[model samples]
Target: MTMDRKGLSPDQLKEMYRQLLYPRLIEEKMLILLRQGKISKWFSGIGQEAIAVGATLALDPDEWIMPLHRNLGVFTARNMPLSRLFMQWQGMQEGYSMGRERSFHFGSPEHHICGMISHLGPQLAVADGAALAYRLNETSRVVLAFSGEGGTSEGDFHEALNVAAVWDLPVIFLVENNGYALSTPVQEQFRCISIADKARGYGMEGITIDGNDLLTVYDTIKGVRDYCIRNQKPYLVECTTFRMRGHEEASGTKYVPDALFDLWAQKDPIAQYEQQLLKEQLLTEDEIASIRQTLKQQIEAELEAADSGSTLIIDTAAELDAVYAAPAITALPTVTDEMPATEKRFVEAIRDGLYQSLERDAQLVIMGQDIAEYGGAFKVTEGLVAVFGKERIRNTPICESAILGAALGLNLEGKKAIVEMQFADFVSVGFNQIVNNLAKIHYRWGQAANVVIRMPTGAGVGAGPFHSQSNEAWFVHTPGLKVVYPSTAVDAKGLLMAAIEDPNPVLFFEHKALYRSISEPVPDEPYVVEIGKARRVQEGTDIAIITYGMGVVWAEDYAAAHPEISVELLDLRSLQPLDHAAIRASVKRTGKVLVLHEDTLTGGIGAEIAAWISEHCFSMLDAPVLRCASLDTPIPFNTELEKNFLAKQRLEQSVEELLGY
Candidate 1:
C-alpha cells in the first residue's frame, strides 16, 4: 500500500506502466481514426504520459485535477471508463460533454476533474478557487492544475499564482514544459531558466525535474501535495519533457528538426520505463508483452463500441432549457412579517439584498475592488465588511479575469460568489472568462456557474465615456448568461436576491444614475422577483414602448406626458430571457412598437428586440418596429452633451414616428 522514493513495488510498477501504455495506444487509435476521417482532431500526450500518470496517481481521490488537452493519461489514471474516453474522442452523446464539445474540453463533477477549454491559463485561477474552498471546508485535499510551459506568459497564470500564494491555498501547479508551444520553441516563449523558478516571485516553493522520469514525478508530486496540505500553500512543479508528435495529428512534426525528434524518440518515457522494470527484474519480457497485448485488445474493443454508439440528435428546446437554470423561487424560504415596508435608496436596497443573502447562506462570499473597507466605487457595499467580516467580504486585486475565474472555482465548491465590477465598462477586461468560461459552462458541460456579476452601468452625471457606459449588450449577446437590470429600489432587492439564489451565472446591472436618486418602500422580508419577466408600468392601445434599465424611467416619463397617445410602457427587468409574451401582448394591442435602451444604436440590445418583433409579430403590427437608443458615439463628459446623447426627446420622437406609421 505504501511506496518509498526508491520506486514502486513490482505490482505497482506494472500498474503505472499500464497507465502510460493505455493512453499511448489510445492516441495511436485516435490518429488512425483521424486519418480515416472518423474523428475531427487529435491532441496526443504521447511523449509526456509520465507526467500525467504520475501526477494524477500521486493525488488523493477526493482532490481535484484540472487537465489540459494533452493530459489523456490523467483520465486513464483517474479510472475514467475506457468506453467513455473513446466516446469523447468520437464525439458521441454518451461522452462526458454529451457531444456538446469536441476534444478534451469536458469534466466530471463526480470525479473532481475539470475538463479544460482551449483558453490556456484561466483554469489556473479556477483551481486556486477550488483549493481555497477545500481549505475553507477543512478538507485535507489539494488540487493539481496542469498547464503548458508557454502558459506561464499569460496574465492569468501570474494572477492565479499570486492569489494562491497570498491566501496560502492548497493548490499544486504543474507546468508540463514540452519545449514547444504549438510551433514556437520554449526559448522564444520566455527568457527565464525554467517555469518553476517563476514561483519564487509569488513566494511559493518551485521545483524542476525530468518529466519522462515517472518515479521522480510521482515522488516529487506526492511530496508537494503533502507539503501544500500541511502548510495550506501552493507549490509549482515544472516537468521538462518533449512532444514527440505535433500539437495535433493534423499538425505534423514538420516544425521540429530531425535530430531533435530522433533524440527525444530515443528517450521515450514508455520505452525507458519498460527497460527500467526489466533491469530491476520487476517484470519479465513475457509479462510486459502480455500487459501490452491486453491493453491493445481492451482499447480496440472500446473504440469499436464507441464508434458504433448512437450519435446525438440536436434538440433545440432541450438545449435551451439546459442553457438557462430555472429560477429558485420556491426553494427560498419565506419571511412573513406584519411590519410596514421600509423606504431605502437603490444602492441601500442592493446592500440590503447582500446582507440578507449573507445572513441566509453561510457559503456566500462577496468579492470586488474596495468593497471590503472602502465600500465600493459607488459606496454600495459600505458597512458590509463590518457585518460579514473581511473573510467573507473580500476585496480583490484589480484583476478581472482572475476574479471571475476564482469565483467560478468557489461556485464549484457550493459557495455563492457575488463579484462586483466597479463599472460595467470594465467587464471587457474579463470578457474571456465571462463569455467563454462562465456563459458557456452550463451548455458545454451542464455545470451551473452560480456566480452573480454586479455591474454598475449607464451614463450620467458627467462621468465620461469609460466610467459610464451601458455594456449589457455584450452579456445579453452571449448565450447561457442571465441578464438583469432592475430600475426600482424594490426590484433591485428582489431581483438581486433571485440572482444570488439562481444556479446560472447572472449579470446584474445596476444603473449608477438611479443608485441614490431612486428611493422606494422595499419589503423587509427576503423575496425573489422571478427572472425573465417584465413589468407593465402602464397599459394603453396606441403605441408600446419596451425598455429596460434607465430607459424604463425615461419611457415611464414619456408615457406620462403622452397620455393622449395611449402609450403602453413595459419595463423588461431581465434582458436575455426577454419577456417575449409581454412584448407580444403589448405590441398586439397597440399595433405599434418602440424598443429603447441606453446603449449606442449600433448593435445595441434594442436592435435585437426590434428585429425580433419584426420577425415574429410583423403580421400583428400596424407600423414598423422603431428603435430609440443613444447615438453611435462615446458618451461625452459634458452634461449637455451627455443629455443630448441619451435624450428622452429621441425616444419620444421614435414613439411619434411609430404612431404616425
Candidate 2:
C-alpha cells in the first residue's frame, strides 16, 4: 500500500485495475456474441485498452473527449451503465440513438463525450471546435482528440492541427498509433519518425509514450492536460500500441506477421498491469477471481435485459418526424408586411439583420475568413467587426472543414454559431462535415447542430467558375438541414434572422446577384420570416412559376413586362422544408406550372418540385410540367456563355411555351 510520484494511492491503482479489466473482459464476451449471431459487429480494443482508460481517468469532469470506435475503455471508465451500452450495440428502442445508429458512432454531451463519425480526421477539427468554445466561454475545458496513424494522413488532420496551434487552443491531439488502420501499415501511412514529430511544424510541443504501460499513459495525459490549461496551447502525443485483434471480428489478420503477434503478446497491457497489482499485493488471487466472476454475471444480466427489451417499431410518421427537428417557426413575428421609412439593398438588409441578431444574443458567434477586419469576401460583414469586436466577430483560417466541425462543437456547448463560406462554391471543401457530421448528428443522436452556414451563393457578378456557382441543391438534398434561398432584400434580412434563430442547422443561401443589385423596403426593426413558407410575389391566372433564389428575380421581371400574361410567381424562400402547402395552393390557381432554378438542369431542386406538382396536381394542370434551368454543365467564365447557361435566358421561352400549351 504505497503511493507513486504522481500521487496514485494503492486504492486508486486497484480501482484503475478494475476499470481497465472491465472493457478487456467485456470485449472478449462481445466477440463471442458476434460469433454466436447475437451482435452485428465488433471493433475490438483488446490490447489498446490502456490508451482510452488512462486518458479518461486523467480528464476533468468538464473536459470533453472525442474518442474513436475502439475506445470502449473511455465509456467504461466513465461508469456508463453496462445495460445501456448493451442496448445501444443491439440497436434497441432504448439505445442511445434509438436504433438510428450503431457501434461508437454516437455522442453523449451529458457525459462530456463528443461522438465521432466514421471519418476519423474530422473529429480532430471537432475537438478544436469544443476547445474553441471553451476559449470563447472561458470554461477552461481541455479536450483530448483521438486519431489513428492513417487518419493523420487526411487533409483535415493538417488543417485542424495548424488552426489549433495558431489560435493556441486548449487541446491535446492524441494519436493512438495502433500500428495499422484497417490493413494499411504505419510505414505506408507517413514517413515522419512518429506522428508526434509532425507537431513541431505547427509550433507545438510533442511526445511519444509506451501506450501499453498503463501508469505512464495516465500520468503523461495528466501533465499534458495541465500544460494545455496553463498556457492555452495545443499539444500532440503519439501512443505506439498494437491492435491485437483483426480490424474487426470479420477481418481476420492473415496479413499480420506471426512474429508481431508473439512480440505484442509478451507486452499485453492488461496482463502486465494485473501482475504489477499482484506484486504490490493490492488484491489477492481469490479477490481477482471474484471480480472476474461478478463482471461475468453482471454482463450476462445486462445482455438478457437488452434482449428482453421491446423490439424496434417501424413508424412511417415517426421516421419522417425524426429526419429534421421540427422548425421553430412559432417564434416568427406575424408582421411580414410592416414597412420601413427607407429602403435597403439586399446586402445591407442582411448586414442589418445580422447586427440585430448579434446585439440580441451574446452567445451567438460568427466565424469566417477575413470576416473580422476585412468584412468578409462580399463585405456582408463590413464594419460589424468594429461593433462586435474580434471574439464574437472572429476571423478563421481558410479551413472550411475544421470551422464547420468547430461550429458543431460550439452548438454542443449551448452556443449558436454562424459560419460564413466566402463563396457558395467553396462549401464543397466542407461538404462531408456538413452532410455527414452536422446534418446527421440530430437524426442519429437527437443533438441538433443548431448552426447557421451563410452561403454567399449563385452565379453572377462575373466572379467566374469557382467563385460563382449556385450549389444550393447539394444541401437541399440533405435531409437534416434546412435550405433557405431568399430573392428579395426583405426576405434576405428576415430569413437571415430566422436561420440564425433556428433550433437546427440551417443553410441560408444569399444570392450574390441580389446583394447589391436589388433594393426593397425592409423593416429597420428585427423580425423573422417563417421558414418552410413560400411567398407569392405576384397574383396571376395564366402560368405559375415556382422558384427560389435568383429564379424568383427573373420570374418577377418577366411577369412585370408581359402585361398580356397573368403570371403567378411563387418565391419559395425555404427549399428543404419546401412550402408544399403554398406550392399546392399556387398550382391549383394556375394549372400550367413551370419550375425554374439557377442550378444545373438535371439534379437541381427544380426536378423535385416538378415531380411533386405532377404527382399531386396533375388533374389540375392545363399543360405538361415544364422546367427552366441552366445547361447541365459548369458555370462558364464568359458573360454570354454564362447568360446562355442560366435559367433566366430560357425563362421567357419556357413561359411562352407553357402559356401557348
Candidate 3:
C-alpha cells in the first residue's frame, strides 16, 4: 500500500515516524534479549506506540510525568538512554540509576519522568500530590499522570481525579485505553462509554482523541496543557488505542477475533501517519527509506552497546548504604538534661515538641489537610506554618492516600515526613498505604520507611462514628509498624520526639479531648521517650493496670482516687515491641493484672495483653487479668452516650471485683 502524507511538515512527519520506528525496534530487541537471557521480562506498548509518542511530545519535560508499564514513549521522549533502559530491564545495578529515582517512582527527576508503579492506580494521586506541592511551592510546573482504562476501576483513580478537579490542580490525567486489561476487556469493566466522560462528574473538561493520529494527539494534548498552564485547571484525555501484542510474553491472542484485528489493522496509527507523510509530499519515498535505515541503525547500535556490556553487578555495600541512610538519633536534640520538674498540659507539650523538632531538623516536613495557616484540626500544628514556612508545613488536597504515598516516596529519599489525619477515624482512607507499603518496606526490601503519622484519636468529642475512633489496634496488629499512645504531655513530647528520630515507621495517636483537657510536667526542652518502655505512673502492690495513650491518664486517676485499692499503673509506650519486661514484673509482683485502652474491648491491645499474660504468667497470676476498654459499638454523637461508651470508669468499679480475686 502507498503511504500518503498530507498537510504535515517534513520535520514533523520525520519526528513522528522516528518516534514510532525506534521504540518498536527497541521493544522487539528487548523481548529477544529476554529470550537470550540478556534482559528480564518487560511489558510492551507496541500497538499503542503512536499515542505514547504523541501524548508525551506535548508535555513539558520540567513538569512531572508518572509513567506506568506502557509509557516507553515517555521515557524515550524524555531522553532516557536506550542502553540504560535495556540494562534496567536486565536488572543491572547501573540500570537502577536515577538522581531522584526514589521520589518519582524510580523515574529520573532530571529526565522529568516520575517513577512507574506496578500497583495499578495509586500513582494518579501521587502525581497530583507532586502537582499540589508545585502549586504550594509557587512553581509553574504541572504534572501529567498516565494510567490504563482498567485502573479507573480503583477507588484511588476517582479519588485522585475528584481531588485534582475540585482543587483545580495543574495536572493532566492521560488514560490510555489499550483494548484489554490482561484478559478483561473494557466492555466488561464499566458501564461508562468513555473514561473521559467520567471527568465531567468532577466538573472537569474531558476529551476523547484518536490516539493513532500523531498530529491529532499532539494538538489535543498541547491544547489541554496550555489550558492547565494558563488557568491551573486539570483535564482528562482518553487516548483510544489498542494493544496489538498479547498481555505479556506468555499470553496469546487466540481469544481475539480475526475481524477485530482486520478492522484495527486498517487504522494502524503508524501506517496512517506514514501514508500522510508521503501523500503531503513532506518526504519523498527515498527520504522515508533513508530515515528508516538510519533509525534501524540506531536501534542496532543501542542493542550492540547493551549486549557488549557485562551483566549488571550490584554493590552490596552501596545498596546497604542506600537502604540505611536514615539520620542518627544523636543528630536530633534531646531534652533529658533540661526538662523542668513543673507540670504542663498535653497540648503545650505537643506544640513544644513540634517547634523543637522543626527547629532541629530542617529536612523535617509536616503536611496534612488544613495544616497550613489553619494550624491543625485540633490545633496541634498551630503556628507551625508561620514558624516553618509553607514549604515545610504543607497543606494537601484531602487525599489521604496521596498524602501518605508522597510521604513514603519522600521518606525513601531521606526526607523526614510527618503527616496528620484530622481524625484517626479517617485514617482508613490511607490504611492500605500504611499496612501494605509502609509496613512492608523495611521487612520486604530492607528499606526504612521513616514516616511519622499523627492522628487525633479516641471518643468523647461527640463527633459520632465518622469523627471519633480509636483505631490504633488496626495498625498495632500489623507487624513492622510501631504504635505510640501517650496520655501525658511529657510522654507525648518525649514519644513524638523519639518517633521522629527513630529509623522505623511510627504511628503517633494524639487524643483530641486530651489536647486541652489534660496536663503533665512536660519539659520545654527536647527529650526522647524510649520506645517499647513502659512507665510506672502510680505505685501499688495489689494489682497492675497496663494501658497506653489517653487510657493511661484514666488509669492513673482511677488508681489515685481508690486508696483502698493499691493499683500498679504501667503505660506501655510502644505497641509493636510491647514492654513485656514491665508487664511480667508487674504481674509477677502484684500476682494480678488489668488491661485498658480507649479502643473497643474486642480484639483491642488489651486482648493481646491478656493472651500474653495467659501464655507466660498464667501460673504466677493471683487472679485472671481483666480488661477495661470502650464497648464494641461506634462512638455516638450524644454526650451521654459517648460518656457511657467508655469502660475506664466502669473498669475502675470492676477493679474492686478483681481485687476480690
Candidate 4:
C-alpha cells in the first residue's frame, strides 16, 4: 500500500501518523486535567494537530520555533517532553525547568527555539528579528512564527510581515486559521479573504494548504522553509483547520454547533491518519491497539514520574540575576568640554549624538516607523538611513506595538535598539509592551533589555492632545526603567548617549516643544551623561528649583529672572534613580525647594521628587517642596488654552512662593 492512496510503504505513512496521534492523546489528557481543575489553563491545538506536527517534521530540529499558546503539538514534535508539557499546564516551575530537554520556559535556547510569548501576533516580529539575527550572524537557521487568522487583524501582524518582507528575512509566518479567534469568527476579525493573501501585499509568497492533510502540511512547510533558507525571504503559510473543540477546555463546544463538530470530527487529523496508516498496511488492528496502549502507558509513566517529583520552583537564582544583574558599564573617554561656543537646534544635537553613537558602536541599531527614507516625522533620522544603511536604520510598519516589541526582542539578543515613538501620545498604544514587558523582563527573568525608547513628548505644537502631553511620570513610576528628559541640545546629546550605553531600559522623553525650539553648543563628540544623576544647571543659596525635561528649561529661565533670590536650578536628566544627592544637596543649601514637571500635578514626577526631598531633606528645609504641574484636565485643543493651561509663568510663581518661604 502506498503513502498516497494505499500505495505507500508502512513506515513512510505510519511514522507521520504516529506523531499526530501522540500529541492528540497528550492534548486530550491535558484537557481532562484542565477540566478536573488539576491544571491552571490549557490552550489545545487539538483538531489542528497535523499542521503543528508536520511543520516541525519539515523543519531542521536546530532551527528556531516560536510556539504560540496552542502550539504544544509543535513543541512535542520538536522534542519537548510530554510530562514537562503537562506540568507547564499545572503551573509547576519544575515543569518549565527540567532536564537536558528544552523545557517550555527556556524553549531550547541552545536549539535555537525561543520561549513562547502570550501576546497575539507580537511573536511574529520577534521571529522576524530572529531571522534577521540569523542573517546578520550568517547562520543557516530559519525562524517559524505561528499565529492564528484572528491575529491578522492585530497591527503587530502587519508590522512583522512588512519587516520580514522588507528585510527579506529567512522566516516562515505560519497562520493556523483555526476558524475563530477566541469567540470572534475569522470573517468579523478581518476583511482579507485569506490570511495568507496578506503576504502578497508585503511582496511575499502566500500559500494555502489543507491543514488536516499531513502530507500537504509537510510538503508546503518544507517548500516554504527551503525557499526562505535559500532566498532569505519570508512567506505566509495559511493552514486551514477547524477547532473541533472550543478554544479552551472551559469553553465548551456549545458555542460551536454539534453538526459542524461532527463534520470536522470526520476529517479529524488523528482518526483520518489512522485510517490512512491502516489502509497502507502500516498497522493491523491488533498492532494499532498495541501502539495506543504502549503510547498511553509511556505517557502515563512519564506523567507519574513528573507527578512524583516536587513542583518545579521558580528559578530563584535566575530571578536574582533578573532583579540585580549588573548593568553593562561602558567607560567613556574624557572630553573636557571647554564650553564650546556654538549653537545648534535641539534636533540637530540629537542627530549629532546619534551619528556619533552610530560611528562609535556597531551594536547600536536605530529603528522606528518611517524613520528610513522618510527621515522620521521631524527629520531626526534624515540622513541616518543612507549613512547606516537599511540593515541598521530600518523602518517599521505603523504598528506601535511591533516597533517596541521588536526593539525589546533585539535588546534581549544583546543589540542596542533605539526605538522612536513618532509622538509621545502614541506611546500609550505600546505602553503595555514598554511598562509590562520591557520594564519587567529583567526584573522577571534577570534579562537586560538594553534598549532606548525615544518619545517626542510635551505640548506646544498644534498636534492636539494625542500628539502632545508629557508621559515621563507614567514611565517613571514603572520600576526597572530609567526615564530621561533632556531639555538642552548638549544635554540631549549627552543623555541620549548615556541612555544608549546604560544596561537598563531607558525612556528618553524628547519634548517636541524643545526638539527644535531649543538650541545650545553641543560638542561634536560622543559623550555620556550618567543615568540617575541630576545636573545643577545654576547655583543658589536660598531656594532649590528642581525640574525635568521641558520644565528644566522653564526652571532655568525662572531662576535667571529671580536673581534677587538665590535659586539653585537642577535639571534631573535621569528620572528613575533620580539625582537624590543633587536634590538633597541643593535643598539643604537653599533651605526651600520647588519641584516642577510638564505632566499633571497629581501623579507627576514632581510628586515623587517632592516625597524624596521631604524624606531626605525635610529637617533641613524652611518650607515644603512646592510643585507646579498642569491642572487635572485634558490638554485643550485650542492653541491659546493649551499655552495658558500649562504656562511657564505658573512654574515661575511656584518658584517665587518657595522663595517667599
lDDT of each: 0.87, 0.88, 0.77, 0.77
Tell me each candidate's TM-score: 0.96, 0.98, 0.76, 0.87
| Model 1 TM-score relative to the real fold | 0.96
Of 1 and 3, the candidate ahead on TM-score is 1
Give lDDT: candidate 1, residue 36.
89
> Mind giving the per-residue lDDT tens digits that candidate 3 earns over 1-661?
5443334466766877787767777777767866887554667777788877877877777777877877788888777777667655654444544221331235565676655555767768767666766665566767888888888888888878887876678888999887788878899888888998899999899999988777778878878888887888889999988877777766877777778778788888777877777786776789878977887788788767866667555566655455332545455445464656557778878878888889998768897999989988888788888888887898877788877876765553356789899888888989887886676555334456678999888787788998888898999877678888887778889889988887777899988888889776677677788877888877789999888877777877776777788888888877876999989998987988888888888999889999999999999898998888888998889989888998764876668778888
- All candidates: CA RMSD (Å): 2.3, 1.5, 5.8, 4.0
Q: Write the per-residue lDDT of candidate 1 for residues 157-190, one digit (tens) a residue.
A: 9989998998889999999999889998999999
Candidate 2 lDDT, 48-118, residue by residue in tens: 99999999999996688999899999988877788888888888868888888888888887788887898
Error of 2 at 55 (Å): 0.3
Return the top candidate by TM-score. 2
Candidate order, TM-score descending = 2, 1, 4, 3
Model 4 worst lDDT run, 10 consecutive residues: 97-106
lDDT by residue for model 4 (465-493), tens: 77888877788777778888887888788
Question: At residue 440, what lDDT does model 4 achieve?
Answer: 63
